[model samples]
Target: MSAHLLTHGIIHSTTDPYAQALLVRDGVIAWLGADDSADRVADPGDERRDLDGAVVVPVFVEPLARPADARDALSRGTAVVTVLAGPEDTGAAPADEDVQTVVYRHADRVDAEAAGVWLPVGTDTDPATLTGLLTASTQAGEQAYLVPDGGADAGPAAQDVALTALRSVAEELGTAALGRVRHRLVVTHSVTAEDRAFLAAAGVSATVVPDADGVLHAPVASLLADAVSVCLGAGPAGDPWAAVRSALSHPDPDERISARSAFAAATRTPLRALPDAPAAGLSVAPRLSVSAPAVFGVWDADAVAVQSPDGRVAAWSTDTRAGTPLLPALDAETALPRWRATWVDGRIAAEDVARDARDGATPA
Candidate 1:
């Protein structure tokens, strides 16, 4: 594999403006320097991609990936952390070997190791059992990602369930391992001061779901006024970007976050669980207009060129690259390899339609 010489592009070793040209070899950024040194740094056989001048950033990461969604995300330079909805969701499949996949399982009767990652047990799961799982995780050096047994409810009933459940976890995870969990403890309706205190002590924070009004302004305001570092919870929409946009422009001053902070909540807030950080140097692109959001599209047309680890220069969503969507709007089901008909294996096998588990499982 030849080293890539990227020139005339705005390069960001840390998303800051101090760097210019960069050399990528074997998928890791091998070197970074000024644009004028291209000749001095060349290996003679290296490839050259001239960046007319676009902004370069790392790849976007999407969490809770469903198997069906992995391929497209990978193609668009997004890596995924997939989940198993339940015992039924355990197992990994023979996936597109080119894509990077990480599988996680929800607590259930099945062994999480069968798939690779172990999620926390539900609130009802016995304390002894919870302790065992957590102890094993820390001993093995895998941090925990959890889904506690209750939802957000500013009301005491929900709080009771959540608090009790969380207490069970805290006792087991202990002070040290508790920090390993994602900071935000998502709730069903609201967060009481009591709930907030416990969460804070555990080195965690809470995010509340708004009431039926579909507005999170009041809850957000309430959370922040307490002098707590807080952010919006992705309500039913399940899209954090939408929530940020809405919460930032909220009419209620109390509920709003500044546009800059809102953007960080959506993009830069690190991944939820962390025994590991995102693979270094991966990046993202924003939408296709000068005034477009800098978070949707994935490349700096003028300054940066993406080189996938596998050596494939995945194309943009549109035909020309000046400013295009990294992923074009299309149906994944019908859109094939531009040559789709040949791979149909005898009409959807009866075996395919009724599988026991989702395909995040590795093949037998």
Candidate 2:
């Protein structure tokens, strides 16, 4: 966090020259000016380093084979952590290297294992042999990474192999394992349009690289650690049961019933029928006028059944009816609302209903 002055050479930021003399304070560049101008303002205790005509540019150095260097890079605020070796160099044992060591330590915290290993398929290699290798690897509890080889082209071939390996591993492991695998692809030099299309078809995850240094040696283990961090860092987005509760409050009687059924299906809980109330204020009340097909009577109370526009039967209490009470105004509401005649033998058959002398009782 202290201030420092760097002078004497061209500074490159990205692929272009940034400045001649750069002044950095609190890990940030305060000013970039001429070397003489920079020296005039330099503080008494400010650390100064001369570049001696060498290019002073930011470069990433990965420490896969060296733990001390990685730690030092981390202390210096390096942006990327890379591993430059293959699995063999790091040892297949999982504990000899930093990446594998971290993964093994974190594996016990989560119920599932996370990691994927991709092997590029070549033109000369038999397709079956590559598949078999992927299957064997997945069966041994390791996630496979795959890339496809597009014919005789070496670049495409390597990518195809990587894709094939990843897909095979995912399929062999099933859904539970699929959820845990760290999906990635491997490419020979650069990812091409054909390589991308192959990846989309295969449904595998990948990272393209030009050579071995681009390949993260213990990618599976490294990915697993990252996955754990991400999982632990994320918070719940919203309440899970909000939609079910809203559906139950729907205004339409049919929609309300449908919502209850849907909720039951989703939660695997048995639903109970709503108790019948006075039919007077029910939303499904029938109407009568020139629209009435015919007048049907219910003798227990002042009510009449009318045929709805859709040819379904409905009843309206005479007290709530306009023009005239269907039968005569009675002390209580009419017969209880019941399920449609067609659904009598369905799930609502267990409910009871009252009958009038003129019209038969219907069970819901």
Candidate 3:
């Protein structure tokens, strides 16, 4: 059996909030706890990875990927990507070397049972088409994708359009159908507080492209302020760090979200939208643990810090007693954390060879 023990790191799991180490056995996370307890479970044949103060986080998910971006997504610590497949594209989506690809297509491309991915609908879609797609998506156990407006420059008008579109879908399809489909929105611009309330009530989740070039893209921080679930996407080839940073560096202080929160949006929130993904079963959120098909990223960070959403205090401390897990400093000024390794299904899919050699991490 392949076995590996990672120690001296922050394990961001709900299973054990203060766990500093974890053991992966035969591609499954068999044990995790404090660093001091790791030795009790350690075996002579297990490979050892010394994190050396690094932080371990669940691998990222790219929600708005395209065919062109598949190659490099895994190396950047994104293990899952929902690729936007066009009608002209033939055959199955090209497989990535390590990343899991879920195919997304326009509603007219194919029936939900055949397509298996979320059906995309827009403001321009006919009501009959929207109803059919929503009903098909519900029967197939998939969320129906909605893009309420032209991205980036859509502005405030987009919010109203989204609300109206969502209401119309609900009316035509019934609340039960809406429940089954669990609609997901791609919001390029801001959503008002009232819009947020309605969205939350309707069990909707929104995906935001933080790096969209237009001046009007809604800040992720603001989307996350209320109860509305928000996930981050920067297109297929966009940088995850840039999106995380953008969410953290909003110009208005009151609208800002914490680095940890922003990171979770990039990594964790997106997973919720992908309920049927194989990797989705890996995370055990309520317990704060992950199982086999274990996927995560290791980073070389200068310092880990705790942040508050209100922007009043920032502190650097790893004490588990603080009630919050520590994350790499992700503010606009701090250098982005350098990725040292990416573990997919408990295997090192990518790594900085020089750094691993220097750190004495032998291949398992």
Off by over 4 Å in 2: 14-17, 26-30, 61-81, 84-158, 165-183, 189-192, 198-364
Residues 1-364 of candidate 3 have per-residue lDDT tens digits of 6889999998777557687899988776788889999988989988888888787877788777667676677667677776666676553344566766766665547634222444444455466655566656666666666654444344555445556667776676666666555677777765677777767777788887754551225656556666778888754237776677666666566566777787788887877765554435443231236554567788777766775655434664456555676677765456778788888777888888887687676432
Query: Could you give candidate 2's per-residue lDDT for residues 296-359 as a string of tens digits?
Result: 1111212223323122334443432232112111112333222111101011111123322224
| CA lDDT of every candidate | 0.42, 0.31, 0.67
Worst 10 residues of 1 by lDDT: 340-349
lDDT of 3 at 62: 79
List runs of model 3 lying over 4 Å from the truth.
Answer: 91-95, 111-142, 148-162, 213-216, 219-225, 235-237, 275-293, 310-313, 316-321, 354-364
For model 3, give the 10-residue run with minimal summed lDDT. 279-288
- 1 or 2, which is superior by lDDT? 1
Could you arrange the candidates by lDDT from highest to lowest? 3, 1, 2
TM-score, structure 3 vs. true: 0.82
Please, what are the lDDT tens digits per residue for candidate 1 over residues 17-129? Answer: 34456665543455666787766877888777554454443333443344555544433433333333455654443255433455555545445342334443344556566
**Each model's TM-score?**
0.53, 0.32, 0.82
lDDT top scorer: 3
Best by TM-score: 3
TM-score for candidate 2 = 0.32
